[model samples]
Target chain A: MEKPVSTSPLGQTLAVSGVSHSYAGAQAVDDVNFVVPAGSIAAILGPSGCGKSTMLRIVCGLLRPGVGKVMIGDRDVTDVPARERKVGMVFQNYALFPHMTVAENIAYGLSGLPREERRERVAQMMSIVRLEPFANRLPRQMSGGQQQRVAVARALAPRPALLLLDEPFAALDRSLRADLQFEFVQLQRSLGITAIIVTHDQEEAQSVAEQLIVMNKGRVEQSGPPAELYDKPANLFVNGFVGHASLLKATVARADDGNGLLRLASGSQLAMPGPVGFVPTSDVVLAVRPEHVKLAASPTPGALLAKRVLSVPLGHLMVHDLLVEGATPVRAIADRASESAELPRDVFVSFALDRCRLFPAP
Target chain B: MNRNGLPFLLPMLALSLAGFVLPLALLGVFSFVDTSGSPTLANYQRLFADPFVLSVLVDTIALGFKVVALTTLIALPITLLYWHASPALRRVIVFLTLLPMLTSNVVRTFAWIVILGRQGPISQALVELGLAPAPRSLLFNETALVVVLAQIELPLLVLPVMAVIARSDGALSAAAQTLGAGPWRILVTVLLPMMAPGFLAGWVLVFAGATTSYVTQSVIGGARLIYLPQFVYREVGVLFQWPSAAAVAFVLLAATSLIMLAMTAAARHPRLAGHA
Candidate 1:
């Protein structure tokens, strides 16, 4: 297939509003609504079977929403069929046509264009994915990463308004996954095309996307910038899913103007701002990220006593598991350093008050 | 074969030798022998010189082609349906498709005789619908034989195709759809090429079964249609020329196997799949 005419690299905003879908009467995607700004990479992150893939399919028009609509740029395309939707998809398995060559696979969707133009477009797409040297190779003859790039090139050759990837790097190894993720992010930014990747790996999502959507069960848990979702989760599920965090049980022992003296299970009272929808003496859970737990040799006013259990060193990050007297384990992460090698058996750990999220029991 | 599998295969090997190999060897010997048990090629020579035998041979080949065509036409769509059918519907379809295989061919042919004979349901329907001037026999015709043989061999044509479609995981069609191809183009370009192996297998199975079939030809076709298998039956039963019958049977077997070999070779050819 030849190359298509050089269209504008600028992409359009994709809006999925009031979208919900069910399979065999069980909900798969529930009332999902999110707007992805044009030319930005967005990632929908969730565990397996958490409806992240379902949401991507609906946005690509692969699966029709039971209710609400989808819009690409300013056009309402909810009623449009998958072929007419102009949204491209790279499947989890790369689904390149087994019988077609690299160039032919890229040219499949470009049949509407002239033959020479389609061929030229295929060549350009191959070079964009750095697959020009393997233009005649079958998908089976290429490596996983090469096949993945071919799939991406095939999806992009038609100049679709929006692109969807379902677990794009799942079939790759850990090292190859990161490399391809980096390449994909770079290519997407250079092309200035809207991309929505569905993955269960939060690190991959965070590394590749500017906007992140965390989903659970059949609903969106949170949708915002990756940093915001990591720093300030809206709920317990998001807090546990997006990053490593330990949730501790607590209750408000005293309440004052916009503040509460929360008592931990260890019987230590830490004064913090009062949480919404809860009164004094109400049981609550506090989400404290590992990085926020500061360790000290001596007991501080608001610190809790814990015995060090084990420490794991990986790259620059060191994770220490410390157990309280009542058998509750609290994990803290600190950067590895020369001076931080030896640790006391008994250490005082204080939670960063601003970094913790106080919430009711899920 | 492993030790355990070797034991399991003993029964099949013994049965094939007793049932297939021994009989084939005997048939070969008898084809070149005279009534006095002396070896001679006179039987084969006389069999080939008869124009009637040639016509029957051509008709049987033509019938093999028609049977394959009709079975494929009826079975391919049904196979696709079974591939995508719901669990409950799939079970019912599988059971229905295998119903003809349960009974012996002789019994099924007897039932077909009653149905395609005069005053049968079809003739009655034709009379009631005024499609025919009056109720008459629909039996003993090429159309009747084709429909009956297709029904008999339909499962053979469908099961292989169903297996292929099941393993494909709907990936090719989904890819085609995402690539802007409509349902028709996907069916033509993606599906048919991939299912070529199943199509060839089913065609060969049905062709061989229908070509060697004797009960259906004798019962439904009666004396009107002189097919190869019927000619062999007559040479042995009526004319008492067992040598000539054996010679004709050998030729039929050789032709069927040769055609199957050619068909398989063509099906596996890479160029057929657009894999340039």
Candidate 2:
């Protein structure tokens, strides 16, 4: 079905700049700045109480920032009231009105329209969410996923300029959450809505976002494509937050011609990549992805031998924890298909030099 | 189950059966009986024929509805105030609102009479301010009865409505505002629908209580405005007519029950259920 052409013009860009907010003298969001491009999904990934939701509220005009401005397209809506902002939101709990039926809930936001138009729009939204069969049922009568769909339909009924979702699938079970994630992605694509979602689950954020902003303690630690952030983190926090990794303490032994040797605490020396910009004798922490480390039967040159402490099977992969030369344990993900003939208690672990990132020790 | 537990529950069940169900059943039986020295329908016949009895019954029903309407009108703002108020302010407001209900109904009725009677505080204040020539009497009127009845039942109306509003998720209203609903529209379209059940419960309760109340009505309205309860009291106590008084009591009981039944049915209707 064709949506009514937006006569007010479309593709409004939202920019939040230098926004800071506090509650009772404790900062909740501090100097956070990011721009959501027109017709793209921006996911804010953070731990609980990291002020991602506070930032979303600020952008949606629900809360005013202490210092900074929010601009949508050309209008500075920092002080505008929430009702006039035309920003639709889907709450974490779905927040569908339990007292209203599916159709009534959908029509609630369109109350300004003519009665006949409101009815038509509600029918249109019900079909969009594929809830026509349960349109007359109250929210309490529907399942969790169905209620979530109704909430989305209700928020989208008015063709809001910017759509905000606060952990929209947090209440759903794993299977339902995955299915709704795909459905939401497809719906967002079809509607071309510029949307922002705040979630603590990294995988969920990575799956739905075109660009991910990793937030920590009321600040943006890093922002980039999910793959880029996972492959090349800008800081120690993003390195651990984006995916599973093992950190190893190491010191640069010698440096010459843009290449150096890193000495581990276990008295093992490994060749470092030339691109790692660090001086000789400098201490740095090495971040290595679990999948990057490989187990070999025989010791290759420059490879370190370690005793396998335990092998935990996780579906198709076995994660082996190894004690390297009596030092701290390191973990590697070995494919179960290839590790079927495993019989060795000791193994050599090695990784390509380019796979490791070096950060200065605190 | 323990035998000792059975003894506790048995007495409660027996008391409820005797104190409540038995009285209602007796009233129903008396509603169909006669009192003209024979097993005829003369009592019920006389009840329907007397214009004075019919007028008093109508007046009672009308006053019941009037009190319910006024109570709801007063309680809506108070409930909203309690809902959005700061915690400390809410505590104080709630305490003050309930202060009236905690007092004896007879005492509150007398307080209203003192304020509304001729040469009373309100009448004297009006006279001194030249709002009226002398102390004008405001008591012994339907308006005074309704006002006093509403004051007595205001807490009943406010508590339930405020409880519903307080427990509401609040997220739905926030979502409505984000969807472009102003405060007024959000109240009417979202908050009110969610709170309809509590409002209906309060209205029915106050209406039932006001229809059956005698103290407030008798004290404020006096003998001039004869409600159904006062009429029944006059028949039984003043005229010493027991059978006729029983017949009038049965009529009032049936009317109040039917009104409550209709309200319950309306509340359960699909159209209203959709909103609530």
Candidate 3:
């Protein structure tokens, strides 16, 4: 694949502070705040109906926040109308102008420019998206992936300070989505435009974004690098949301400042390293990721028993759903080439002590 | 074409033969033959020769164009608003507007007459409000014809456009705005282009309804003002010229068909699309 025209154009900073919105008296996005660095790809990840859509509108200035200030660069655009904000947005549906050709759709944002300039910009965008061949075609005639590229090219044509994408790849198949994701990230990096993408998909977020902002119920649970957020999450929501994790009910057995002891449901005391801010007798939930949960071929210390284990072959690896007593099903990943793939009926599963997270019980 | 489905289509086939095909066949015969039963082009020749007839046809075409223009202007905004309305309000607006389509056209014409008559509410209000001199009729004029025809055809235009808007996935206007086009620019560049099908359907419906409507034009136009439908009605009713009337009606139908074909062709052209 040709490297998509990466020239660091120096994207502007986008900061939204204390942004909150409500629909029909019900809170949708509440007091959400974040600052996206210039030229970086940021993702706002959430589940369905979690106010991500509402927050998207607010960030783009389509809907005024009930209380908040939005800033692009150094200027405060909280009260500015959507049209004057110079923010480029790609809607979830791609929202390509159905009647306009691909060229016209890209030229739509450049209307204020002279005719020659607009045409030149459209041509440039078509080249960047590698859609020159389809420039004369309508959006309906193109595949889902082609339309998505056109949407990105159209938004990037005007060179807005910030580009907002609201789940632009939700319609594509897995392979196509992955290909476009890589191309778009390259295009975004080459263009060096600050972009904030909203998606409910964790994998897409992890693959496409350099910085991930996890949202739940109109609140920002955590905002950091995807890998950092995955390894060390702030709370229970972030732990489960950023990636798959199993939770076990536990209570504080003892604590000081450096290390804490947790009493598991089976009356076993496990030591957890942290500031153990909770009270001495307070309850907590132990969060462990699937990859960190290892299935032992033989009985190992600090290992949990499995009533039944089933390995699902998924090309490169297998997902072993281990039935741990007094806990929800624990899913562990084992290499397809390993002997652990052919597990016995009853086996022992253990968690990596260093990788476990402890959050106060919700 | 399935044997089982063929039986289900019988009622539609029967209705088409009886209601559409049979009358069209009769109109064709009548249009060709004179009252004395001689097949000649005398009626068509006379229709083309007479300046009065040509003017009436031209006036009817103009009226149809006006009807399409006016209905689109009046209905597009309302239809867009209806599309954006809450579910409860949308139901109420739909019921109120489409209620007229269910009511008899003759009844609606009479209602318009009462409203625009010399002693009607409009005239009375105009006199009382000192906007007009004494009690004058707002009916029996070209302007009055367009106004009434637009009202009668507004819902027809609105419903089809509303259907098109409802089927869209995202708010194109919002997308356009974020892309830096202002509201007016968005309307011109994005929404209007996206709504091309809606406008095309609305224009065709309003044009056909306006050009063929006899009751509304006669009652609203009164005796002084004459349109193609009124001219056709007079040919048979007063002059007792069935062949001439049938010929005129057929010409009107042909004109409507040609214009509709032109419109459909125009809709295919990207630059010319939705220009109407």
- Give the TM-score of each candidate: 0.90, 0.84, 0.91
**What is the per-residue lDDT of model 1 for residues A33-100, given as tens digits with 9 covering 90 to 100?**
99999999999999998998788777777778899899999999888888777788999898877767
Worst 10 residues of 2 chain A by lDDT: A1-10
User: Taking candidate 3, what TM-score does its chain B reach relative to the real chain B?
Assistant: 0.90
Q: Please report how far candidate 1 places residue A309 from its true position, in Å.
A: 5.5
Give me the runs in candidate 2 sitting further than 4 Å from their true place: A1-5, A23-26, A97-101, A111-124, A246-288, A292-311, A320-332, A342-362, B1-11, B30-38, B82-104, B107-128, B132-138, B271-276
lDDT, model 3: 0.84
What is the per-residue lDDT of model 2 for residues B145-213, given as tens digits with 9 covering 90 to 100? 898899899888887777677666657777888877788987887777777877887888999889888
Q: On residues A1-362, what C-alpha lDDT tens digit does candidate 3 reach at each position?
A: 42222221448898989998888899999899999999999999998988888887887889999999998889898998877777888988888888778898898877677688788889998999999999889888889999999999888887888899999889999999999999989998888889999999999999999999999998999999999999999888889988899888889988866877788887876776565667788988889788888787688877777755567878888888877864557888867777534578788877876788878888
lDDT of 1 at A266: 74
Instruction: Judge candidate 1 at residue B236 and give its lDDT.
Output: 89
Fnat for each model: 0.47, 0.75, 0.76
Top candidate on DockQ is: 3
In the range B20-92, model 1's lDDT, one tens digit per residue, is: 9999999999999999999999987887898988888888988999999999899878876775587798888
Q: Docking category for candidate 1?
A: acceptable
Candidate 3 deviant stretches above 4 angstroms: A1-9, A253-261, A266-280, B1-7, B83-92, B237-239, B270-276
What TM-score would you report for chain A in candidate 3?
0.92
